[model samples]
Target: MSLIKLSNIHKRYGKGTNVFEALKGVSLDIEAGEFVALMGPSGSGKSTIANILGCLDSPSSGVYDFCGVNVSELNIKQKALLRRHYIGFIFQGFNLLPRTTALENVELPLLYRQVPKKERLRISMEALELVGLDKWCNHSSNELSGGQQQRVAIARAIASKPLFLLADEPTGNLDTKRSVEIMEILQNLNKDSKITILMVTHESDMAKYASREIVFLDGKKKSDTKEDS
Candidate 1:
């Protein structure tokens, strides 16, 4: 069974004369343990698809099934619960609190889930270690470099051991070298941990890291191809 399935999905903003369609009958299926990349020009609905995949937004019409559940039928609270338990997100901005330590930043998700303090600490540390940031756990967000900050962000996302990760231009703010490093870490996580990943990136080089690439144009899927390993 597919981990994610979207059938003839559509998204619209406003109504009538003011209406704008962001997704036009977009459909896709992603299997578990696959690393997929979404690529497109600005306003191509790549971000719209990403948001829908992450449960940040629902499709305006059509079916969206996630792990066999009809996500389109879920209520707001149900969607929130699903995201909290099964979905992890990484953003381009690194989104960490300035004064907070890396360990604390990673623990924030667990706190929301009501995990015990000791267990949260343990799991957060493990996540940090996975991203090779264990030594920087005590360092504040401001003290870290761009790469380190992104690692912390990745650590935070994986702290809950989510079923899948949704990364939105995660390396957009990094230099070529740092971006490559981040991609390597993500690749390793997919290979070694069998974690599913859906990443959005404008850079073709960055997209090359994924096992499959899906391109969008004018709110429509243009191509979907598997990369040669």
Candidate 2:
């Protein structure tokens, strides 16, 4: 099933005198459980596309159908609901709460869903275990290593069991070895849990791990490659 459909999407910033077209008439389709990578240089609309997928921003003009629902005209509250219910986000910066333990950080999102305390803890611990962070559950974000912090972030992202995972430059801050480890974890989630994964990255090697790769240039898609590997 197609989980996301974008038709003639347009995203612009500023007004007449200082206008900038971040995304120019880009259209794409992503199917459920498919792993995709969006790659491009800076100013190539990569981040803009991620924002649109994450519901952090909307396009200026276009049809955005997410899981069969048209979201182009959704109000802030509606968008927020969708974001909380269906979307999981991973970023270059780990974004864990500074003073919170790994378990608390992972449980935070489930708490928003009103999950009971006991169930929430169980689910959060499972998520952390999936990321190989169960042993560090009680450690604060600041106490964890970079790779561990990102794992905590991933645990938090998956705690809600979101249908889609949208990541922007998720490995940009890590060393090559750590980056590969994180990518392996993400690939495992996509393969084992069947979670749809879409990531925006500038690294070709990283994009190669995805099932499909879409390259953008000058605010438009320049090439799209699908690998069987």
- Give TM per candidate: 0.98, 0.98
Lowest-sum lDDT 10-residue window in model 1: 220-229
Error of 2 at 92 (Å): 0.6
lDDT of 1 at 76: 96
Residue pairs in collision within model 1: none
**Model 1 agreement with the true structure over 43-149: per-residue lDDT tens digits:** 99999999999999999999999998999999999999999999999999999999999999999999999999999999999999999999999999999999999
Task: Estimate, for each residue in 1-229, the C-alpha lDDT of model 2 and write its tens digit.
Answer: 8999999999999999899999999999999999999998999998898899889999999999999999998999999999999999998999989999999999999999999999999999999999999999999999998989998999999999999999888898999998999999999999999999999998888887799999999999999888865
Candidate 2 regions off by >4 Å?
none
Q: In terms of TM-score, how similar is model 1 to the real structure?
A: 0.98
